[model samples]
Target: MNEAPNRNRPAREVIAGDRRYVWHPFTQHGTEGEPTVIARAKAATLFDADGTEILDLVSSWWTCTHGHAHPKLNAALAKQAAEFEHVMFAGFTHAPAVDLAERLVRLLPGDLSRVFFSDDGSTSVEVALKIAYQYWINRGEPRRTLLLAFDGGYHGDTLGAMSVGRGSQMFKPFRDLMCQVLVLPYPATFEGDDAVEEREAGALSAFQALLAERGQSIAAMIIEPLLQGAGGMRVCRPSFLKRLVETAQAFGVIVIFDEVMTGFGRTGTLFALEQADVVPDLVCLSKGLTAGYMPMAVTVAREAIFEAFLGESFDRALPHGHSFTANPLACAVACASLDLFEEEKTLERIQAINLRHRELLAELQRRSDVTRPRVLGSIVAFDVKDIGAYQSDESRKLKAWYLAHGLNIRPLGSTLYLMPPYCITDEEMSRAYAGLIEGLDSLKR
Candidate 1:
């Protein structure tokens, strides 16, 4: 009985094995179509089992900042693996993690000097949530358990993250189990948005009322900064963010900026907080932290907030950490990715992407099918009109059509968006926009 004669031999076998046992994240296997098996990938392009090249428009869920399999990051990962793969991070320190932490501190704003390692975006949010809760408790305010977040903001899928991301509709089944989190209106704005003042005032009034009533009870206020990614890529003004921070701070509520999606030059700055000149008490960062090369996240806090958790007694200190905390390989790749920001001028490339997106938005405005067009740095999005399905069937149809025509785009309900890798070429961008227009035309007929 030698394992049924070892029949598993080919690529198809591997794929079949995946289909048999693998349960994918954020996907419906019963109703939705089968997953496309990717074989190899490179900068801005992914190859399927049949070697069909698909231009990654959404950057594989808005990661892959420099692109897939970037040489520098790959080399760094290999070097680090050869030297030291991983080490338990409780008492030991590694050069890669330490250097990466130092680099992040310099890049971030204000006194966000302390970094706590984690595995992904959800854990990062969890870390921030825990830190904020304990920071108040450590300072002798154990009654402050209320957490505040914006409407239409999607944090992550963990219990704490989902509590803050109630507006995203991703956790309907577990709605009853999440902790208490208050949702405030988000003043989402776009091009030629003159009603922002009114919306901001209304939001401020609501926030003020909430703070006045529960200001002493609230532990922290977390936000997605200038852009809400999973909530239809809804962007707000920098002034709105600044004002929101000020309002939260005035209430003595700890401020946590969920920069998981907007970090690493996605919003025309290294960090979205820099664009608004706002200093949050804690910042949750992931996504492009390793330039999409590895899974890593950091919850960095201001010195004052970090100090709240310090004490001689074990019970007084924060006792949360992941097994893979500060994994050396992830840290090494992250360091290399940061280096590319300076060596390859990544932010400048983002500016070029932004310019192109602006030009595309101007042209897209002429098309009747496109509505509420918005462009933020490398991200461009618009809703397709008269598609009947909107966020449901229409979005699926448009996505399938795009895939058939050699593109990878995942639309949010009625919204079609493009957040291509920074290494995407001008010709590719033009082709992607052209394909989108063609999809809209087909939908019209």
Candidate 2:
């Protein structure tokens, strides 16, 4: 195979060529700034083509777990690539895929024993939705057509994902193409909020009321567990999740946990569901599944759910699969990534990061401009007051400021959040916090 002639081109020329052909995700090319050309990354820092070192505060969109260019992950990738990169996963199965599936089943909470592989977070959600829908159909209860999701919850950009996450307001143009999904008010909370319980009660009450009225029609309810990532980093109480799961399960509704963002120690645990102690009927996992090294996802379901689809005929089987389903290289990398979690004590690192976040966010909360400071595991987020929508001038200004200060921090509209890699040191975190304080102060000026 031959490589592109411009593979060795200068960064500026490469960027220029990219601008001419490539369209970036969630970016307005007409207004957004020039995309930075990243040369390499290691640990918690990204090196631009110009040799500028920028601290990765958002863990490269909250996917990176053990850090970039981890030796173990790299070795696993190289080893797998040298053996056989990929094979059609329809009838054929490989050791890497099988091993990964087994490991995931053992690691996940409750009786989540069956795994269906797909590509990326969106497809994982799509698979979960299909499984929930088909599981009901297999059980001769196809009337459960409605799917419930929380307000402001962002699953993904795919058609099915968009339908479930319709409240995110990112898919207005394609709204008509999506399936109808029921939305529930999320009991979003922050630091020092006294009305959290009241809000939780209200949400629970509303959810119970919905279940009472339309429980028989609802097929499943999907959630982002404790931390709603793209939904402005909204943090909810674990107790609320527990109650929500219990209520949904009682109504014979399948509970799907979209742990795409919260899995693999992001929420101070191996998975966010462990914090709530609630076992979801189906769990969608991606992002950190391969420690950000590969694009792979798995929707794990209960054994009983899997058993429902078992029949001799093709009609009975769940007819959903991707071309790269259970790619061997991705599976190999994911297994290695999971191994490092135990070898490197990744959960302990997350706990330390969580403690640092609380301390820094506490000080940030003192500023009148910063509101609704919240921290969970390695994540820290706060809202900026007086900033209009997600595409407001203030958000752009703050993003540029953070970039100028050697920090790769992206603000979600006015919601500034930090989710640095676990390899980040105390000093590095302090520098990020200091830059945040300076940036907030600059906004005042």
Candidate 3:
């Protein structure tokens, strides 16, 4: 087909084409620079077409679990592709999908036994929201119309996901189109913050009062357990999550844990819910599901919720399906990625990362420019003092500084954070931290 459109085009030509045609996500193309052209990646390093090796610190947007081009994951994808690429998932069932479902059922907590495959994190959340809304209708209680979400919790970019994540400040243009959601205060905490207990108590009190006022009319209460990713890497205590779940359960409110970012060993556990010792009615999982190799997500539901959607009439069934719902390649890669968790002792790696994070954050804490240092599992974040806004000058400067130093890091507003891949070596991590220190030092200048 026309020589496959020149497989070996120059990097400049590719960048020119992108400038002409590409519309990047959450990007202001008018003001932003050219996108970095990554030609290849290995382990935790990405190589640009110009032969520059960039250390991946954000896990390529918090997706790469076992790192880029992992041998085992690559082999799994190759084996599946050799057999079959893809088939419509509506009526067709494949071994890879079934095996993934079985493994997820075993790995997930509580009664999250039913897995509904979707394309990405947003769709997984959309599926969960739809299920939650329809479950009450199937149960003959269609009055549960309101949805609740914690402030600063971001689910995804889709409409339904955006509706719950409205407070995340990315959906202002589509605010009128979004459904009304009751937003609760988030008890975000940091190291050496003595007021955390007070904040937690105040948040709980507010939630309890809200439940007392409008618990019956609520359909579901969704949150990003432990860590809120896009909302600036804000972390809460596991005890707060447990208490929140208990309060929601007491009010007969369905709880949804949007574990899209915190799942699959990122949180030093299989899932964030496990650390909290809480079981949610529905959970949205993606991002690291396929170790960032393939686009896949699953909205896992409790058996009770699944049962509500089953009936004699087709009207009662949850009507949702994507053409590539459980793509064979994605399923195979996800299964392989999950296998890596056990074989490679991924949780232990995450724990080690946490220790390093604490050490690095402690050093950063001494800097006057850094504030509110927080660590949860593999995530570590701190806010820059007196930064303007989300796309502040200081934030952009720091990002450019990191890239110039051969490190990849994207700051969320004033929040500078790192969510490195599990395969990152000690030296790589030290390099990343050194870059961070240099960037912070530049802020003083």
Clashing pairs in 1: 391-413
Minimal lDDT window, size 10, model 1:
1-10
Tens digit of per-residue lDDT, candidate 3, span 64-181: 9899999999999999999999999876899999999999999987888999999999999999999999999999999998999989989998898999999787788999889979
RMSD of 2: 2.7
Error of 2 at 407 (Å): 0.7
lDDT of 1 by residue, 69-109 (tens): 99999999999999989999988999999999999999887
Residue 250 lDDT, candidate 1, scale 0-100: 88
Superior candidate under lDDT, 1 versus 2: 2
Q: Provide TM-scores for the models.
A: 0.96, 0.97, 0.97
- Model 2: pairs clashing at backbone N, Cα or C within 3 Å: none
Per-residue error for 21 in candidate 3, Å, reads 1.5
Per-model C-alpha RMSD: 3.8, 2.7, 2.7
TM-score of 2: 0.97
Best of the two (1, 3) by lDDT: 3
